[model samples]
Target: MPRIVLHDYFRSSASYRVRIALNLKGLAYDQHPVSLVAGEQQSPEYKALNPQGFVPMVEIDGERVTQSLAIFDRLDALVEEPPFVPSDPPGRAHVLALALTVACDIHPLNNLRVLRYLKTELGQPQEAVDAWYRHWVVEGLAALEALAAPQAGTFLYGDQLSMADICLVPQLYNGRRFDVPMDAYPTLLRAEAATLALAPVEAAHPDRQETAQ
Candidate 1:
């Protein structure tokens, strides 16, 4: 096996997803902690490695990959067992839709950079920014609930864990941080509970990581 190095921050939801995917794939990797809160991602050192300066950057096979979903897709291709998305077109699209709902729709609007931009750049008070976070989370979760509930069984898609579940857990962690009321999305809550209960998934949790604050 080739050496794998993970460049990440402990609290980054994107980094958290990559950790979960690696644990799920049973791959081992070294970690280099980059503090987003302290603006370490803007340093020249990390910028040389990833011009985008994004967390969850995975280096393996002489290549550095950015973006959590891309890393997950690569890992699934790397290891055949416990596939991330289904083999069939429809199934793959369905699962990817669930994952994208969180990644593209929910996460972008509420990530740390956006929140900081809201506060420092836009001069929005913390109260309004927090409300902005909660509102988007609720909307995304409601959409996920509707889409996932129909196919959900033990996990978000079915009994087997997919990329959707990997993406879902991290978003829920943020929703909890923002104190968004989640009780209404019983289906999502059930899937989240099931996903977090897995030992591998638990091992990748932000609080459990060595670099956690």
Candidate 2:
């Protein structure tokens, strides 16, 4: 297999999700950090690699994969041992539904580009922008908490950590970043705590600092 190279930013929740997936699968990859805050994602060189100019682009065996969900599916197909999606039909559908609840229904509105546009173009005040962020998070999380019942085991669906857990950890991380109160979702809090206890997941945490050069 050709070396897997991931173009990502440490702070991006999308990139963070992919990183967690890679770590969970025990796949080794090279990291090429793209600083979204510094406008590096919009440069001609990076744009040529990804016209969308988004973080979390993955190059695997010379095939470039864009979109976090697509990249995750590819990784899941490549390594079948630790399955990310459930095998049973109904369970699989439920897991995918929960993952999409976060990836599609919630994440886009809170993306960095959208926030930047809100501040610069719409001239939305910081308080309003933050309110928007919290609103989506709280609404989405309420639905997700309902989906992740106490009947479910340590992880989201059951004892095993599936894609839903992978998606939830980063979104919860972002929610705390934005000061969205999490006390309402005790099940989600427990699931996140259990998922993070795993060695691979803990190693992949975004805040883990790199050594000085």
Candidate 3:
């Protein structure tokens, strides 16, 4: 096995997703912290490795990979146990839909850069920015709650752990951090609770990371 180096921030949800996948696959890796708040991601050297200029940049035996979803797929392909993605087509689509609801719809809206733009560039107060965060979180989670309420069992999409579960646990963590109203999403909460109980998921929590501050 080759050395895996993960360039990540402790609290980044994207990085958290990859951490869960790596832990679930039982792959050990070294973590190099990239402080998103300190602007370490924008340094020219890191940008050369990941033009996206974000955490969760994975270096496998010196080869680089970016994007959480792509990394998850690659891990699934590399380590053959407990597929991170679903095996069936419809199952895969449904899981990806749920995952994207967090990745594309909810996360980008509330990430550090966007919120910083709201506060610094637009001259919005922290309260206004928090309101903005809550708005998008509520909107996206509402739809996800509906989609998940029907299918949720021990995890999203029934008892088996899938990409949906992997994506969701981190989002719920973010929701808690922002104090998003979550009572309406009972099914999502249930699945989140179950997912967090897994040893790998617990180990991947942001607070447990080496760089957590």
Candidate 4:
């Protein structure tokens, strides 16, 4: 098999999602840290590799792919067993809906770039920026809690760990970072606890992947 390489920032939720997918697929890969705080992602050489200068850029099968959701899908396709995504159309729809609630709706607003813009360009204080992060997190997770509360089992969609759980664990990590109150989403917390118990999911945690200074 060709070597799999991942370019990611330790704190990026987008990068974190790809890490979970790779672990679930049981693939061994090299991770190259890109320090978003130090602006490593904006370096010309890195931008040449990923025009968008995004973290979680992955090289698989000699092809470079960007976007965590796209990488998540590719990994599911590459490995059949221990699938991160569902096969049935209805199952896929439900899982993607939950995943997108985090990946698309929640993540972008609180992304590093957006937060930087809020603090630097928009001239918001750290307290205000942190409040911004918490507000959106609470809003999105509240809706997600309602959606998953009805059908969630050990994982978001059922007993099987699907893409929904993969997307969720990292976002929950972020929620904790900004001190977002989590008790409002008990179902999400339950799924997160179960997902984190999995050896693969544990391996993917950002704390485990941090680059030594």
Candidate 5:
């Protein structure tokens, strides 16, 4: 396998998702920190890697792949063991749906660029911005809790930790960062505890020093 390099910021939820997937697969990769706070992601060098200037662009076998979900899918295809998506058709669809609920419906509303726009362009107060952040998270989490309640076991998709679990863990981490109350989602909380207890996830957690940047 060629060297894999992850171009990401420590605090980016998207980047966090990819990190979890990589760790779960037990793949060794180099980290190339892209500081979104410092505007490093907008630089020409980084922009060339990903035109959207997003963190979590992965270079695998010298191929630069953008987007967290795509990177995860690609990684899963490359390494078959410890499959991220379920083998069963319906189960795979269900997992993808849950993952998309967060990736598509929730995360976009709270990304750094969107929040910055709310504060700078819209002139929204910090409190208002935080309220907006928590609102969407709570809404999404509520839906997720209902979805996971029946299927959830040790992880999001029952006993096996699938891609949905990888996606859920990061969003849960983001929800906590923004002080979104998670007491309503008991199933999610339990799954999160189980996922985090895994050695790879524990080791791959975002470093406080790196995130503070």
Candidate 6:
């Protein structure tokens, strides 16, 4: 096994998810923090590694892997101990659908770059930007609530921790950080609490990271 390096930001939801996956798989890796706020991700050197200039880029043995979902998939293939996705096609699709609902629909709309664009380019007020963030989180989480019966199970899909739980935990972290009210989503909140109690997830928390302010 070669050395693995995780290039990520502490508060980044995508990075957080990858951290959980790596820890869950019991993989050892050095964390190289890229300060997204300080604009280090856009630097010439970092951009050379990742053209998209995104956080959560994993460098394994010399090869670079981008995208959170892809990284988790590769990790699953490499280490079969704790599976990342379901084995069956339907089960896999179901888990990925839930994961993508948060990663694609909710996260993109409220990420740092988009929020900055709203504030800097569009000149949106803080109140309006916050509203925008909350609106999307609530919308996406409502659908997730409908999809999951978390009270019956420890995780999003079930007893087994799947990609959906990995994805949902970070989204909940972001939601709470933004002070978005999640009272209406009981299943989501319950699942969030349960998921975070796991040692890997707890270790991967944003506040526990070295870059945390």
Best by TM-score: 1
Give the Å shift of residue 77 in candidate 4: 1.5
Model 2: runs farther than 4 Å from truth?
209-213
Q: Taking the tens digit of each residue's C-alpha lDDT, what string does model 1 give over 90-204? A: 8889999999999999999988899999999999999999999999999999999999998889888878889999999999998999899888898888888998999989999
Each candidate's root-mean-square deviation in Å? 0.9, 1.8, 1.0, 1.2, 1.3, 1.4
Model 5, 1-213: lDDT tens digits are: 768999888888888888888887888999899998899999999888789888888898899999888988899888887898899999999989989988998999999899999999999999999999999999999999998889989888889888788888889889999988889999888888988898887766777325543
Worst window of 10 by summed lDDT in candidate 4: 204-213
Model 4 lDDT tens row, 66-128: 998889888877877688767898888999999999988899999889999999999999999
Indicate which candidate wins on lDDT.
1
What C-alpha lDDT do the candidate models reach, one value each? 0.91, 0.88, 0.89, 0.89, 0.87, 0.89
Off by over 4 Å in 3: none
TM-score, candidate number 5: 0.96
Compute the lDDT of residue 32 as modeled in candidate 5: 92
Candidate 1 residue runs with Cα over 4 Å from true position? none
Per-residue lDDT tens digits for candidate 3, residues 58-121, read: 8888888899998888888788888976788888898889898989999999999999999999
How do all models score by TM-score? Answer: 0.98, 0.95, 0.97, 0.96, 0.96, 0.96
User: TM-score of predicted model 6?
Assistant: 0.96
Better-scoring candidate (lDDT), 2 or 5: 2
Model 6 regions more than 4 Å off = 150-152
Report residue 161 deviation for candidate 4 (angstroms): 0.2
| Candidate 2 residue-wise lDDT, 5-38, digit = tens | 9998887888888989998888899988888888
